[model samples]
Target: MKQVLVIVLALFIVGCSSTSKVALSEDRFLLTSNDPEYGYTENKPIELGGFLRGTKSAGAHIEYFEGLMGPNGEKVKVTRLGSCCEFEDKSMPFGGGLLDRYQLTYEGQKKPVIIYVNLYKFNKPLAPMGFALL
Candidate 1:
């Protein structure tokens, strides 16, 4: 009985630790918008793609850069875009990453436009990553 109790306690501790790690990783990248028209928005869906760094077996890093073009042809470059880890869980086919949202405001516009950028890197074999405005 004592051995069983010890095993159960160890399992429980390991499970909680794993959960906390995931949560911490998730919180690293934050999603936020500042458009009064849209109010505060969080956790918006985003498509991921672009230059990938690292490998699946040893973990990977995903990188993407995009720009927002205004009606006048002015372009705003998005820097420090986003990132995701590709080797969190091997059992799961798909790996999870972080999402970032940006709000662009310009003169003469009544409201700012909200853009969603998703960063994802998975261990499973997948297609090259890229992103498009939605």
Candidate 2:
């Protein structure tokens, strides 16, 4: 009986443990959130279109932040963190692409804010909420 109980406990522990880790870039369980936050300020992102702007690589991302400012006209620094949230699109031959996530930091702010840019498609983007347009 003692040996049987030990085996049962070991099996239970092994069953609870996960063998694989969930990757940050996993596309199997991604949320499709294309809704633009035009009214509210939360999760506001500037639409940076590369194909429409005739740009490749990070050129379009650079142009979007060029001459852009913070809420109080503070010089905003744009940093390309990486890409996330892949989805299907007619623009790409593979029918899928990822949005580039940028880290925007400027003076007089608590910390930094992350902005998502969709460079695959072109849509004239308005100034992001709480940002000053040049």
Candidate 3:
């Protein structure tokens, strides 16, 4: 019985860690907005949603970024800086959720760009201004 319980727990952990869901397409990923403030600001961060699907929050972040490219359609590398800016949300634990921040760099970018993402609520992911959809 103990062995069975251990195996079950291990399976659960593996399942939660895998990012099995593919992100939405570029056209469907971002909102049609030209303002840089749209995704740069934590107040209006890009929404990745799908948090209730049982996958880990970090996995969702990676999944979404996989479908993105640089402003000039260049391949971009992303690093998760960390989580910040907690806000009230009925669907999230303790009635709030935190936004995830990422640093994006491309071949020609002079400086890395910081973008915000939300996972707690389901919102249409918007392609940030100055970013190219892949």
Candidate 4:
């Protein structure tokens, strides 16, 4: 009887430990964008489509950078994208990098929220003489 009791106790401990690990691993962040239109704007808002997850109690950060422009007046350069993670709450404001501003909008209750971010506030002027809008 003593051996059986010890075995059961060990099994219970193992099960509890596994459960805790799974709970920790369940946290994650999700980001997506669609119908993306890029242009240089002064204090203009750009719509970034995406959803976030694993942020039940907090919000995430997002980074934005300017892309290179082609001769045909099109953007070609791409920079490192930043991200937000574990925000204090969904209502908290989060932004990063150049023009790092994000507005999150959620659908009803069960749907993912849309993240609208401004991309140019973080960009630096290319020419020392003057600044040109893309």
lDDT tens per residue, model 1, 2-80:
9999999999998875542111222222222222222123343333433244533222213322322333323334434
**Residue lDDT tens for model 3, 1-134:** 99999999999999875433334445643544577687799888887766566744535555667767665466678888999998887866679889989888877689898998887765646568766554
**TM-score (C-alpha, index-matched) for candidate 3:** 0.66
lDDT for residue 94 in candidate 4, whole number 0-100: 57
lDDT of 2 by residue, 34-119 (tens): 34463123234455566444455436656557745665556777788887777677767669677777777876679887777777
Each model's RMSD to truth, in Å? 18.9, 16.8, 13.3, 19.1
Colliding pairs, model 1: 49-129, 49-130, 50-129, 50-130
List clash counts for every candidate, in order.
4, 0, 4, 13
User: Which 10 residues in a row give candidate 2 its minimum summed lDDT?
Assistant: 20-29
Per-model TM against the reference: 0.32, 0.58, 0.66, 0.21
The candidate 3 region of ten consecutive residues with least summed lDDT is: 20-29
**Residue pairs in candidate 3 whose N, alpha carbon or C atoms collide under 3 angstroms:** 29-125, 30-126, 30-127, 31-126
Point to the candidate with the largest lDDT: 3
Every candidate's lDDT: 0.37, 0.59, 0.72, 0.29
lDDT of 2 at 114: 76
